[model samples]
Target: MLEISRRGQAMPVSPFRKLAPYAELARQQGRIVYPLNIGQPDIETPPAALAAVRNADIRVLGYSHGAGTESYRHRLAAYYQRAGLPVVMEDIIVTTGGSEAILFALLTCLNPGDEIIIPEPFYGTYTAFSIAAGVNIVPVTARIDNGFALPPLANFERALTPRTRAILICNPSNPTGYVYRRAELESILGLCKAHSLYLISDEAYREFCYDAPYVSALELAGAEPNVVVVDTISKRYSACGARVGALVTLNKQVYVAAFRFAQMRVSPPGLGMLLAEAAAELPESYFDESKAEYQARRDLTVARLQAMPGVVCPRPGGAFYVLAHLPVDNTEAFGQWLLESFSYENQTLLLSPANGFYQTPGLGSQEVRLAYVINRTDLAAALDCLERALLAYPGRTEPPLTTTEVASAFTAPLLTQLQ
Candidate 1:
């Protein structure tokens, strides 16, 4: 038998997709599955972005500059400048996607066995990425009860160690949809500055910030050397397949180091560069309609979840995701049961088990993250399936029977699994 690398063995699986085999089996059995598990947007990719590929004259499909095409970088820089991040083309290095940018950031900023502080229930991929980069993740737990707000400065102070090298955050976060207040960002940046630590911010969902203004890590005054932003066009333009993202920094040293790593990969995706440049050309007003649509969907999702007994969902300020506690014991088992055993009107729903989002053991066992990316009609249908499933779910830790439920001996026994 061949031995595998220890690092490869330790890579965490994606919570969003880990149950895909169950979903496939459900589909094969003729059940319709509405996957609310992943943040793959159902919104149409901008026509301009698609056209850039369809209309391009390049026959060779050759490699672009390792730092990405200079023209594309300029386009990205201009787009950032409008967002109030004062960056030039030289300040950015395009990568295959946000994942690659994160890799660049991690590899450049921290040594193997060094630690990067990240809040709990963060983007799940960060765990895999850190493992791949040979870095240790130090999680400062943030409570779901507080809408996943940033833990206080003292929390960061307490987590610090000699091996700590950086902190990573996702604004309008991926799983919980929590947007960091500017003051929170400042305080975190102050911690980084005080400790001479790097701050890597994943701003992929910036455009979808619904309630409050999105604050980029770049906005903090005089912390250029301490801040690095990882960005992507996936969610912004509904162009996940484009695979274009950037590592942005005003610090010359970090930029140079990340660029060197970029060269080793030859270049970022070529066609993606074209697609992103086209997307960057889109007007700022484009986000307005998209934001409104997502905001409405977010409202629909939260309202539906809140109405369910024993469900606790905090209204998130931004992003298209909602992290909610269900009445179940282990959400992974519950999610699998939804695909394997339950259906309403021949329909089933897929959900991301929230435990995979946390580095802390057993933290998200009772939670699930739902993405409200589908349009209202489909979203409504999916939520309907979820509600009925929860009412009938056998794995729930306790009965969530209501007055109406108590009135029905039918619902009461099912809620308690007494049958």
Candidate 2:
């Protein structure tokens, strides 16, 4: 029998879908499961984008240029410029999804033994991508008490080594929903310049910032060669199935290398590109309405989590996610229990345990990342189920902490363990 490659064997299971079997069992047993695990939003896709695909007069669904359709690239560049990222057609290479763009960035910038430093409790897929590329990830842990803000500069500096080749960040981060402020970005930019490292900014949730303004790495004055932005239409336009995303940068060498890899993949999705182009043309009001809806959901989520006994969740500044530290020993086990044993009013909620988001062992065991992507009614129902589950969980250990105790315990320099 042939042995599997070490890289293949080491790929981390998706935190979002790891409990899918339990969810399936619950469904089979006639329970209505409100899925708060994944980041799939309940928002409707733009009518214009759907209509573009419907009205396409394609005689053949032929392969497009490897770098994506030229017309679409031009339009996308303009879209980026409007969003405060000065880009041109030569700076963009459209790909299947933000996932592919990330893989391409890792493949293009670093060799097998090279290392990339990233903030911990990151998007889980980054770990899988690094494994596939045979690269190492050095994580700098960020505290939830501070709303998972960018870890200190000294932490990042301490993590850097001779083999470090890049620094990756997810703005309006996926699980934490902590938006990097302009000052924070500038500090990272300065370090990247000093270290000659590539900065991979995943801006998939760029348009959903609530409390603070988003500052793109591309907007920085001297970040041209160091910044490679990974963007997708999945969360932005509610077009996840379309699988359209792009790698945008002013670094000519990186773009050339990524384009070569793009050729290997043949072409991006055809209909997806059409939808993306249509999405680019949408009025500013589209984003305004969508942002308002997500902000409302975020407010509701944080409020509910705070009201729960032993739960301590910081209000997120952006994105539609919150990482809540629960009063449990292991969230992985608690998540399974939620699906396998718990329900309220014939309803239960599915959640992604926060452990998988951390690369460091023994971190994030007591937390869960909740995506506020559902409607208010469903979100309210899900919160009710979660609160009731905590009350009835067999492993329940402690009472909820006050805001001050929560802050001091979760935000302090040293990692805190529940008493």
Candidate 3:
């Protein structure tokens, strides 16, 4: 008989990947599905990065250094310096991706039963990585009404047990796409220092802010000795396939500890490093243009969603997602209904239920995450389908009134009348 480890039994499959079969079915049915569920961008990778690979003169595709090619690391350090996340080559460990960097960070920093605190409506992969590394993920809830900002310092402080080892923050958060403000980041930095906790800041979408300014955890250098910054070129370079990222830190002890895990793996992708090095050298203007395009898509998506009945979507400052609170009883069911039952003009929208992102069960049952990863024309149609589905879909609760007469659903009646 085959047996699995206790961790394997207790661990859940990734919620995002589970939807693949259904998405495939829809594609085969010839339904034009707008992928609002994942962050795989449709943007073009810069020619410089692509050219670096095509023009490479490799003879034998040999494994590079375990920590990645020195030239690549050195160039990466310089790139971070330009982005305000100053680092030295020795302080950076180029991993397979931000995902591997996270796993390594957890494995190196935490032992079994040790905990890492994360906010609710987080990136789903974080949960899986924590479990794989035998670390408990303690989630603190952040409200959608408040634009998914960091929970108050007191909330994090209260969740802290003696076994708490680190606080993980995903800036310009996934799913919700809300960017962290300077003051909020400062508050959390103070708490990390006070509690002597390692702050693992995941800045994967550092350049995606569309509203409020972004604050880097690395910027809090003089405050503490436990800050570990995790970053990747996946989203930045529109190179999800690149599989190149880094674990950066100024904390010498933590860096040494993390490096041990790096040594265990022979090396990360070699060809990917060549592309990543060129990506690191991509001109600043490339990012400026990409950010502008994402901002336009976000603006169109939010405005259209806000017009729909029973939907409350806040404009995100960064990232390419919008966490929308819908009128349905369960977002999980609503997501299925969108793909399985309803379509408008032969088009349907694929959404990720907000429940998976929320660690607290039943809390985000009425919410769904919409990734504005498509062009404006496609996004408009997707929003239209969502509006039609909201009206037609049958759920447990009475649907919110989304009639043309009512422009705003959440506002007080008096306010609506005044407007």
RMSD for all candidates, in order, please: 3.9, 6.1, 4.3
Ranking 1 against 2 by TM-score, winner: 1
Pairs in steric clash, model 1: none
Root mean square deviation (Cα) for candidate 1: 3.9
Best by TM-score: 1
Quote each prediction's TM-score: 0.96, 0.95, 0.93
The residue-by-residue lDDT of candidate 2 on 240-354, one tens digit each, is 9999999998999999999999999899999999999998988778899889989888888888788776899998989889999998889999999999999878999899999
Q: Each candidate: what lDDT?
A: 0.90, 0.91, 0.82
Model 1 residue 403 lDDT? 51
**Candidate 2: segments with Cα more than 4 A from true spot:** 399-419
lDDT of 1 by residue, 112-184 (tens): 9999999988999999999999999999988888999999888889999999999999997989999999999
Clashing pairs in 2: 310-400
Q: Give candidate 3's error at residue 8 in angstroms.
A: 1.7
CA deviation > 4 Å runs, candidate 1: 400-419
Give the TM-score (vs. native) of candidate 1: 0.96
